[model samples]
Target: MARRQVNPRDLDLVIAAVHAVDPCPADQEAAWTDRVRERAVSLYVLGDTVGQDIARLDAAKQFTATLLDVRVEASSTRGVLVLRNTSGSSSSSSGPTAAIPRPGGR
Candidate 1:
């Protein structure tokens, strides 16, 4: 193959940009794990909190809004953490309600 000329300036710029954004692997990995865990907890807690709010609502719209939020969280299967809700109404369990993680959740 014929030798190709390289742009030293462009290469140096790329190197500088990469160095500017360098992250400690261990620290970043830990941070990412923590964020994922936090998001999972937030999603779970959001459903429960909305359900609690719905319990106190008499208007259909208010109750429906909260219910919708809960339903979305209950049904979410995408992402690293999957939350499966079981309830007589949810079709997952023949009971009032339960939130269970999918297999291999941890």
Candidate 2:
């Protein structure tokens, strides 16, 4: 059970990249990026190989892009986070939508 070491600078780069592509507000972007980084660290600690954790981070980036696209395209007032089923039976287009409460109840 060796611990995987991830460079903090690398994590910062990933967060910056996601924020650049994300349409969410600055506050939301910071929060989501932190959450994504935490998840990647958790995965790495839970026996995921370094490559697996990197892939997971990549998927998180993709998720951010998809969520932003969906929200903009849907013209949603409430923040919408799209959840994709990873099971082989579901396609990305058929994923479920979760409404996120926007800041200041907007």
Please list the residue runs of candidate 1 whose C-alpha ends up more than 4 Å from where it truly belongs after superposition: 1-27, 58-106
In candidate 2, residue 37 scores what lDDT?
Answer: 67
Q: After superposition, how far is residue 56 of candidate 2 from its true place, in Å?
A: 25
List ranges where model 2 is wrong by over 4 Å: 1-27, 48-106
Q: After superposition, how far is residue 50 of candidate 1 from its true place, in Å?
A: 0.3
The lDDT values for all models are 0.46, 0.51
Cα error, residue 60 of model 2, in Å, equals 36
Clashes of each: 0, 0
Provide the lDDT at 21 for model 2: 52
lDDT of 2 at 5: 96
TM-scores of the candidates in the order shown: 0.27, 0.22
